[model samples]
Every structure is written in C-alpha cells, then in structure tokens.
Target: MFENLSERLERSFKILKGQGSITELNVAETLKDVRRALLDADVNYNVAKRFTDDVKKKAIGRNVLTAVKPNELMVKIVRDELAELMGGTAAEFKIDGNPAVILMSGLQGSGKTTFSAKLANLLKSKNGKKPMMVACDVYRPAAIEQLKVLANQLGVPVYSEEGSKDPVSIAKHAINEAKNQGCDVVIVDTAGRLAIDEEMMTEIAAIKKAINPTETLFVVDSMTGQDAVNTAKEFNERLDFDGVVLTKLDGDTRGGAALSIRKVVDKPIKFVGTGEKVDALDLFHPDRMADRILGMGDIISLVERAQQQYDEEEAKKLEAKIAKNQFDFNDFLSQIQQVKRMGNLKDLVSMIPGVGKMVKDMDISDDAFKGIEAIIYSMTPEERKHPSLLDGRRRKRLAMGSGTSIQEVNRLITQFDQIRKVMKQLQGGKAAKMAKMASRLRRR
Candidate 1:
C-alpha cells in the first residue's frame, strides 16, 4: 500500500547506518529524508513537519544502548511517532444501543455502500450482532440494489422503500423496522454526490439528526490522497462524525489519506477496507499499521487472522492423521481452503516479519494456489484419500483434466510430499516432547 513511502523511509534510515550514536547532525540528516518521504506519500505538509520535529525532539542526544544500533533506535522512535500520528491506538466502534444506528457519509465512489455491507458482515459474524442494512440512497436505484445484493449474501435483512425519495424518512423507518425485526445494529447507507454540495450535505445532516446514529463514520477513498482528507474535514465539520473509514487501502495508494485524515479531522480511523471482498475489512490498528508501513510486518494481526480460521477439533484430527502418516490430498485441500478464508494471499504474506520487503516488487496474485487446487480437484476420491495410488499415468490424466501441464502436476505432488514429510517430523517432535514431559511429571 505504502510501498514507495516504505522504500524511501528505509533508505532514509540508512543515513544512520554504521553511526556510533544518535548525534543531532545525523538525526537531522535522516529526518530530512523522512520528512521528504512523508510529503511524497501525500501527507499534510504541517503534519509532516510536526512529525519530524517530534521525532527529532525525542531522538537527539538520547544515549544509544550498546546493543542497539543508531539506525535501529531511529526506527523505533520514528515508528512510535508514526503510531501516535495515526491515532495512537485502535478506536472503539460503538454498537451499544439496542438498535445502534451507524450513519455512513462520504462523496460518491468512496465505497460507502460497499463498506456498509462489509461492516454489517463483520458485526454479524464477529460481534454476534444482528445488523440490518438501511438503504437510504434514494437517488440511486443501483445503490439500493447493491446494498440488497450484499445484504442477501450476508443473510442480513435490509429495509428500503422502493419508490420513496425521502432519505430521512427511509432512515427513520428503517430504525423502527430494525427494532421490530430484532436487529441490534442498523447501518444507514446514505447517498453521496460527486462533490460536496448544499443539498447533499443538508440531506445527510437531516438524516443524521432524524436517526441519531450512535456512530457516524466518514468513509473515504484512501487512493484519493489529500483530497480524501479535505473531504473528511468538510464532512466532519458538518456531521461531526464519530470516526473515519479508509476504503481501497489495498490499492496503489500513497497512504496520504490514512496518515493525514485523523490529524486534519481530529477523528479516529475505525476501519479500513483492505480488498474488495466483504471479509477483507479490518479494525484499524495504528501501531500495527505503522509497523506495516515501516516494513516491520504485523505478526499479531497475522496470528489473529490465523486463529479466526483455526478449529481446535480440526487441528487435533489433522495432527492425528499426520502422525499416522495418513495426511492426504483432502486434508491438504481443507488446509488451503482455511488459508483462503484468511484474506488476500499477498497481504497475508506481507504480514510475516521481513517478508514484505522481499515481495514488495513482486506481483503475488491471489490465485497463486490455483494450479495446485485445480490439480487436487481433478483427482478422484480414491486418489485424494490415498495419494500414493497416483502413478505417472494417473498424473498425466489428471493434468489434462485440470488443464495443467503434466510437469506442473508432478511438481505439486513433489511439493505435497515434502510438506507431508515435514509435518510428520514436526508431529513426531511434539510427541517426543510430550512423552518426556510426562516422564518428568511421573518422576516428580
């Protein structure tokens, strides 16, 4: 997302490389480049200046520990400042009322409607809340249909009057409908104009006043850079939104909006849309994002995503199967499915420490596993269950069926076998450790 900024920041930090201490001269040299990087990333000029000043204040004359290099210390200081610049911590999303109302506000093409559905999905699946989407975009028929389609996919209810032109009325009625339907959260997706105007602002303001939403979020397209921040400021002045939502963060964005919007509008960023998928939504964590921007990766978030797809029973069963040397294509396919549910493949890989830099210039597609998945799907039930039965002739047949080369099929088999062997060895190691611990307990 902030690929260019990250690379520039990395290069800037190299100014302190091989330095014995954090002298003012070197610190200024490094932060000058840092400030340039932020400005190039489309950050607000004042914000960039203040950030570098704060970093300089904390960095200069600080006694560097013998174990920590000057560059590493500078990175730590910069990372902390970046986190503070981006709201310091994850903002709490308010969904406390019996039928909590959340009003979505932004210009057209800000992904407001799509993010409403994504938030509904997140609340329904994660928070155990019944979220009903309210389509208040009376001007756009397609917007209503889009909300309906998204709601249908999430199995959430939607309240919309087809012919009604009154958005405030639709929003108010939707709240009542949500109360009747026992929906705890009502997300009102309001209409947006190509540009902010008196009519659009007045309508949305009236709707907010009528519904009295518990949380009014300003959704902005991060790819728009400073324009997003400016729009956010105008909306915040009018609606006084409770938080911000940055959509299209996975795009080729300079990340100016994410870094500047909070500072300019004085609001916390509650959520970020990482990809187009409904499941690609994430709670905005400033520290984690700062880590990602600095190319340090976000392991905690990565582990949390993995834990979401982890099943205790499934893991035990898989472990038992692997321990028995019976790990098969079916198990492999199931594992792949779980990983797929974790979100974008490239994004997932970027979360691992130090892996982001290596793949920054690479085009790691979401379909990286397509060939293996296809090859496995083409296999018969018997072959999947007992992979050893797949001889050379069977592989050729499977290759033609999957539209993959025979060599591609053979490579998958080889890799699968290697993975199976490694998993078995790891399982054996765990078993040995458990046995030793048991013996120690008995002796005690």
Candidate 2:
C-alpha cells in the first residue's frame, strides 16, 4: 500500500550506499532525501521534521561496526524511529467489563459497519467472546439492517430499536440485551456524517456518555491520507477515544494516516481493516509495519497467519497421504482453499523476507488460481482420487469441459507431479527439520 513511499525511501538510503563511515555531511544528505520521501507520502510536515531530527541525533555520532555498513546502520535507526512514530508497540484491546461496551465512531462510507462485524467475528473466533452488535445509526436508512445481516452471518445477536432516532437510548438498551443474551462484548456502531458537523459530534458524544464504553474506537478511512489524521484529531477532542482503527488499509493508500494519526491524536491504533472479508482484520503491530515499510518483510506475521489455517489432525492426514504418494487434485484443491482463507494473496506473499520488493510491480490477482480450480473441477471423481487414470483422451475432455486448451491441462498435470515429488523430498533431512518447526508453530 505504501509502494511509492517505499520506493522513495529505498532511493534515499542509496545516498549512503558506499560511504566508509557515518559523517554529518553524508547523514544530512541522506536525511534530506528521507524528509522529502516522507513529505511525498503525505506525512505531517512537523512529524517528518521531528522524525528526521530524531534519526540524525541517534545516527550521526554512532560508530559503524566492522560488519555493518553505514546504510545498514541508518536503516536500523530509521526503522526504530518509524515504529516509535507509529505506536512503538501493539496496543491492548480491552474487553474488560460485564459486557464490554465498544463505541464505534467515524464518517459514513469509512467501512465502520463492516469493521464492526469484522471485530465481532475476530472476538468470537479468536478471543472466545460472544459479541453482540448494536446498530445505533438510525438516521441512515437500512443501517440497522446492514448490521443485522452482518451479525446474522456471524451468528451473533443484534440490538436495534427500529423507528427510534435516539442513539444514546438505543445503546443503553443494547447493553442490557447483551447481558441477558450472555454476550460478553457489546459493540455499538454509531452513525457518521459526510463531514465534521456539530449535530453528528453531539449525537455520538451523547451516546458515548450514556454507554460509558470500555473502549471507544474512532474509525477512519486510511485512503483519505491527511484528512484521516485531521478527522481523528477532531473526534479525539470530543470523545477522547481509547484507540483508533484504520479501515481500507489494503487499498492504494500512501499510508500517511497510519504514520501520522498517532502523532496527531496521541492514541494507539488498535486495529486495521486489511480487506472486505469478515476475517480480514489484523491487530496493529507497529514494529512489523515498520519492517514492511522498509522492505524487510514481516516473517513473524506471515507465520502467524499460516498458523491460523493450520489444523493438526488435517495436517497429520495430509502428511500420511503425501508419504504414501497419494496426494492428488483433491488435496491440491484443499491446499489452495486453505491459502485463500489466510487473506489476500499478494498481501500474504509480501510478508515473506526480501520477496516483497521482487513482486512489487507484479499484478498478482486473488483469482490467480481460478484457472487451475476450474480445470480440477472439470475432472471426474476417479481422476481426482488417482492421477494415473488421467490418460490423453481424458485430459482432452477435461480441457474442453474447463474451456481450456489441452496444453494447459497437460501443464497442470505436470505441475501436480512435480509438487508430489517435492513433497516426497520434504519427508527427510533438512526439509523434515523445517516441517517439525512448522508443526510446533501449528500447535502453539
């Protein structure tokens, strides 16, 4: 998402590339470029200045190690400062109450309603909490219905007083409903305006006062750039929210909001909406984010996501089948679906170390696996179970059924054979060691 900024930062670091040591002249030259990069990324001017100042104060007088290059040392200094500029660490999302009330605030079309459901899904699935959603956006037509639909998908309860315009009263009743339903978390989704207005601010403030929530989150569209930071400042002045939530972070945003919001409002970013899926939410991690911005990748987050989709029992069965050389199209398709469940394909790929920059210019679509899936779906049950049964004639028929050329079908069969061979090799030695580590992560 911060493609432009990443590129600019990379070029700026090149100014120190062959320098034998860190000097005031070289550091100043590199930081001038860094400051320009931050400004181009829409970062706040004062923040950019202070960030560069901090980096210089820590960098200029530092001794460059024999093994570490000047550029490498500079990168470490900048990465640490970037993390500090964000939030320094992950913020705790407190659900500590009889029924923890979380008041959601933001502008309309900021994906507030959608994120409400995402949060409910996360709490129910990960935190083992029964979350009840309260739709208090009575002024917006069908806002309550939208919350109901999202809550219904998660099998969570929804409290909404139809025909009631008083959001504060509705929120108060929703907490009671949550208590009766044995829900441990209550997320009240309030209405938003097209822009900052007195009536909108007053209504949400009253709702917050009535609910006395455990956590008040101000949601903002990250793609709005500087405007997102400005809106957060205004909201923080009124509600004094516990944290901020940046939505639409998966879009082509310059990432200014995420970099500047904390400095502006003095609040931790509790969460970020990565995609439109109900499970596309991620707890904000400033250090990992700083790594990604510097093109170092985020292996920890990638492993965590992989761990989420790992099933011990299923892995045992799959390992057994692979050992027996019985891995087929069905198993292949299952693997594809598991990867899909992890999140966006490109985002997942970008989490690996040093790979993000390589594929930054590639248009890796979520539908990259569509053709293979179609071809496999066209296969007969017997063909899927045993790849040996797929003769030339059968492949031609499958190609015709899947609207693909015969050559494409043949290529998939060859690729499947190669994958089986690789699995066989992974059953021993160094590969087996890696597999053991992965197993431990799954169990963790």
Candidate 3:
C-alpha cells in the first residue's frame, strides 16, 4: 500500500550501510533522504520535517551497542518515529453503550457508505456484534439504495426512511429501530456534501446531538493526500470526531493522509478500508504499519489473520485425511480457498518474514489460484475425490475442458502429491528431514 514510501525509506536506511557507528553526519544524510521520501509520499511538509527531525534526534542519541549495527539501529529509530507519527497505539471502537451509536461523517465520494457496510460486516464477523446500518444520506437519491444493497449483501439490517429530508429524525428513528431489533451497534450513515458546507455541518451536528453517538468517525480518502488532513481538521472542528477512518488504502496512494491526519487532528485512526470488498476492513495498528513502511514484513498480523481464518475442526479433519493418503484435489482446493479467505494473496505473502523484500518487485496477482481452480473445477466429482481415477484419458479430457495443457495438469498433480507427502512427514514429526530440505533449498 505504501510501496513508494517503503522503497524510499529503505534507500534512506542504506545511507548507514557499512558505517562504523551512528554519527551526526550519517544521521543527517539519512534524515534528509527520509524527509524527501515523506514529501514525495505527499506527507505535509511541516509534518515531514518534524518527523525527520525526531527520527534524527532519536537515532543520534542511541547508545550504539556493540551487538547492534548502525544501520539496524537507524532502522529501529525510524520505525519507532513512524509508529509515533501514525498514532503510537491502536484505538478501539466504542461500542459500550446500550445499542451504541456510531455516526459516520465525511465529504461526498469519501467512501462513507462503503465503509459503513464494511464496518458492519467486520463487527458481525469479527466482534460478533449485531450491527444495523442507518441510511441517513437522504439527499442523494441513490445513496440510500446503495447502502441498502450493501446491507443486504452483508446480511445486516438497514433502517432507512425513504423520501425523508430530515436526516436527524431519520437517524433518531434508526437508532430506536436498532434498539427494537436488539442490535448492539447502530451506525448512522449521514449525508455528505461535495465540499464542506455549513448546511452539511449543521445536519450532521443535529444527528449527533439526537443520537448521542458513542463514536463519531471522520472518514477521509487516503488518496486525497494533504487535502485529507485539511478535511479532517474541518470535520473535527465541527463534529469533534472521536477517530478517523482512512479509506481506499488499497490504491496507489502516497500514504500522505494516514501519516498526516493523526498529527493534524490529534485523533487515532480506528480503521482502514483496504479494498472495495465488505470483508476488507482492517483495524489500524501502528506497529505493523511502521514495519510495513520500513520494508519489514508484519508476521504477527499475518499469524493473527491465519488464526482468524483457521478452522480447528476442519484442520483436524484435513490432517486425518492427509494421514490416510486421502488428500485429493478437493482438499487442495479447499486449502487454497482458506488462504484466499485470509486476505489478498500478495498482502498475505508479503507478511512472511523476509518474503516482502524478496518479492517486492515481483508481480503477485490476486487471482494466482485462478488456473488451478479452473482445472480443479473441470474435474468430475469422482476425480476430485480420488486423484488416482484421473488416468491419461481423463487428464486429456480435463485439460480440454479447462482450456489448459496436459503438461500443466500433470504438473499440478505432481506438486499436489509432493505437498501431501511433505505434510505427512511433518505430521509424523520428521523435523530433521524437513530441515534438511529447507537447508538444501537455501544452499541452492
């Protein structure tokens, strides 16, 4: 997401490469590069300057232990400074009140509606809360319908009063409806103007007054860069928002918004919209973001994501099947699907330690499994359940049906067989054999 900034920061760190110790001259050289990188990323000029200064001060003040190298210490200092710049710790959403109300405020086209749906889905799936969305964007004719469609897709209830011009009353009624439905959280999606206007401010203020939301989030487009900070300042001046929601982070945004918003508005970023999908919302974590910006992978978050998507019962059953030599195409497909469910393939892979830098220049498409899935889907049920049933004739037919070559089909079968064998060895606690293979690959 912050690919440009990441590359620049990595280059900045290289200024300390082969250096004997962290010195004032070396730190200045590196901070200059760091400042340029942040400015290029669209970070506010003042914020960027302050950030680099802080990083330099921290880097130079380090004790320079004999165990740690200068470049490593500099990287650590910059990572800490970056984390502080982006809100030192993660903030939790307030869902404490009975039928807690969360009011969403943002300019038009700021992804408020989409984020509302994503938040609902996140709460529903992650927090196990019953969330109901209230569509109060009554000005736009299609806004309410859009939110309704998203709510339906998320399988969440929507409370909206069509043709109602009064957003405050609509919000009030929606909250009451949420209470009636026993919803734990009521998210009121208010209307947004093309720009900041008094009328829009007055209406959102009234809605906030009426509903008395536990959390008032100001959603901004991260692609807006410095303009995002200005928008947040205006919104916070009026609504006094509790947190920020940075949207469209999956895009090639320079990452100016996320870095500047917290420093400008003094509000923690509560959530980030990574993609357009309803399940693409991620809780903002400063440490992981710092790691990402430094070109270091976030293994902790990766493990957490895996744990979230890992089904213990399903894993047990799959292990049993593997032990019995019954791991077929169907099982392989299921495993791939589970990994896909965790997150985008590139993102998930980049979370592995050392893999991010190794594959930073490589193109890993989200649909990396498309060909394999197509081949598997072309197989008959019996063939999927029993790979041995796929003889040469069956392989040719499957290849034709899947629009792939026979060689590709055979390659997949061979890889699947090898994977199953390795998994069986692991299950048998053959760590020495696995370590030998890993060592051999590394040597190669």
Tell me the whole-model lDDT of each prediction, alpha carbons only.
0.93, 0.92, 0.87
Candidate 2's residue-wise lDDT over 9-86, tens digit each? 999999999999999999999999999999889999999999999999999889999999999999999999999999
The residue-level lDDT of candidate 2 at 412 comes to 95
Local accuracy of candidate 1 as per-residue lDDT tens digits, 338-385: 999999989999999999999987988989889889999999999999
Native-referenced Cα lDDT, model 2 = 0.92
C-alpha TM-scores of all predictions: 0.96, 0.97, 0.94
Candidate 3: residue 366 lDDT (0-100): 82
Candidate numbers, best TM-score first, in rank order: 2, 1, 3
**The best candidate in terms of TM-score:** 2
Which ten residues in a row are the worst by lDDT in model 3? 434-443
Candidate 2 lands at a TM-score of: 0.97
- lDDT-best of 1 and 2: 1
Better of 1 and 2 by TM-score: 2
Q: For candidate 3, what is the TM-score?
A: 0.94
Candidate 1 residue-wise lDDT at 183: 94
Clashing pairs in 2: none
